[model samples]
Target: MMPRLDSNTDPFRRPNTNHINSIYKQNLSKFQNFSEELTKRYDELTPTKKILVWILAVFNVIAVVLILIFHSYIIKSLVKLSDKWADLKFGHLLLFTLVFMVGFPPLLGFSPLSLLCGMVYGFPYGWPLLASAMFTGSFASFLVFRYLLHKQAVRLIQANEKFRAFSDILKEDQSLLILILIRLCPLPYSLSNGALAAIPELSAWTYALASLITSPKLLIHVYVGWKLKSLGDETKTFATKVVDFVSILITGAASALTTWLIYSRMQRKLEIYHSSRQQTNGDYDAMIFGNFDDNDLSSNNNVELDSNDFDADNFVIGDEDDDEEEVELDEVRAETDQADVTKSTSPTNSP
Candidate 1:
């Protein structure tokens, strides 16, 4: 039963604030749902697996300490293998190391290898060697996938719902933009390689163009290594060492921030695409992004303006029109939408 308003109630108070509260609740509910989705897998872990995770985490901490102490020595030993191809009379070539980072299983990976380039070879020499290898390796992989493995890759993508959804988004005009964003993200090299490879229509030129945009990212690793090398000089004063340490920290923070922003923007795009798909009834939106609730495709997505009886003089300064309700944007062209204008103007008409 609806409660009747008191006749002597303060008119300045919002007479019907339920709509705003409901909107706030819907958003809060979505956030909770998202949080639950993220933690579901962790919550489901068995006792044995949880113990294993802790053991591995402890070992990882120990490994990090050991690596930090002997990192420079280890990096140098790895870089200077003394293989004839790697060791010329002039200087050691890091091409093979970078190539291995790009190829199957992807050992050591791009991050450590590029850092090794900067630390061992140092900049001016390190930047170009690593940059050229990244470009050429990515180009070669794109060709290999697009021609040699196209059929198998297509079959694999078709067999997976998630990959199929990813492929669909790639076909859009924003495909190149998406690729550039993915490159900027701090994901595994092989992961990005497989994703780009799956899209049969994605050209080598387009892939190269996206890769070029991320050229600055490789420089970040080299820059960090360069800074680290500066800190190792025994002759440097305390103040100089402090400055170098701070700069390395700042550079690392900046790189992390850039990757986070890029990843967040990509996520927002996916959410928007998910919302639009829900509106248009795209059944497959759930595969890539998680499946949403009725809140997603709410029938209440159109504007609804209603008044039991609005009083202008009763409105006080700093207080909104105590009774109005506004909903989501439902684009209505006046010329074409004139027919539906009388459909519903009451807030109660929607969910």
Candidate 2:
């Protein structure tokens, strides 16, 4: 047997203990490991990129300090900027609408960008600004996979039994609910966009509409940002400030409770969904997703399919007349899986 490595060991091995201090320690350990992983990746960047990264870091620190020192001035400037934006509001909002569609922005991730929007436009503007963007962006991905890159995407999906089985749950009733739950989950946006897009059973408009269920999360984040923006207002009386503080407290508590409830509900629904899926498909095929944990849904990780798992059961290799197409698709799946396997598995992955 191969020797077990400490680096491969999981921190979650301990028995459940709901103490607050234990929770803090667990999170601290995770954060430390996450930072170390980020540092290692940063080291692998090119020298030119490293210089640009340092410059960006320094600028961010300076910007934060300036914002802290001149918050009142900054608020006044922002208010004036908001007034100026009114004349060309759609043009400004339209530009930001493209942000989520663009994916993991180099410097600014979606969270901060969404918060910035909330800070600028407030809560009422939240869904109105992002609703069309989210739907359109997701639909565009679907279109690419279904039409533009259909051959490439379909070959990948058909390459693995797991991928096909994952798609097969569409046969079950309330499949749309599962689709909605998926969009509601905090999975990587673009990957989910492409994954759902690649599935033939899911219609373009159906998939796009399911995305709207996630709008509440956008609202919660933007509402918090709106509150943050309000805190900077110099005109508020002490009583009003107190009121705002209390409102923030209420919002935070409600959001936390609501998120927890939704998460729990989604998990239970997924368990049932998987159960029904397993029963419908053969036991061998269905168990592929059986091992998947719902809590892992919170992470930004994506699984790449391995073509070695491909077989006649899931795929339709083209006829004699379409010999060129069969060979091309087989080549495509093999090449794609080779790249995926290389990226996912290193020397340490070997047993």
lDDT of 2 by residue, 140-249 (tens): 77788787777666665565443454465554543667677656654556655655557767888777667766666677767776776676677888788678768888
What is the TM-score (0 to 1) of candidate 1?
0.60
lDDT of predicted model 2: 0.67
Can you give the TM-score per candidate against the true fold? 0.60, 0.49
Error of 2 at 159 (Å): 19
* Residue 320 miss distance in model 1 (angstroms): 59
lDDT for residue 99 in candidate 1, whole number 0-100:
51
Off by over 4 Å in 1: 1-38, 43-52, 67-92, 100-108, 150-166, 282-351
- Pull out the clashing pairs in model 2: none
Candidate 2 residue 109 Cα shift, in angstroms, is: 8.1
- For all the candidates, what are their Cα RMSDs to the real structure? 21.8, 22.4
The lDDT of each candidate is 0.67, 0.67
Model 1 weakest lDDT span, ten residues long? 323-332
**Each prediction's number of clashing residue pairs:** 0, 0
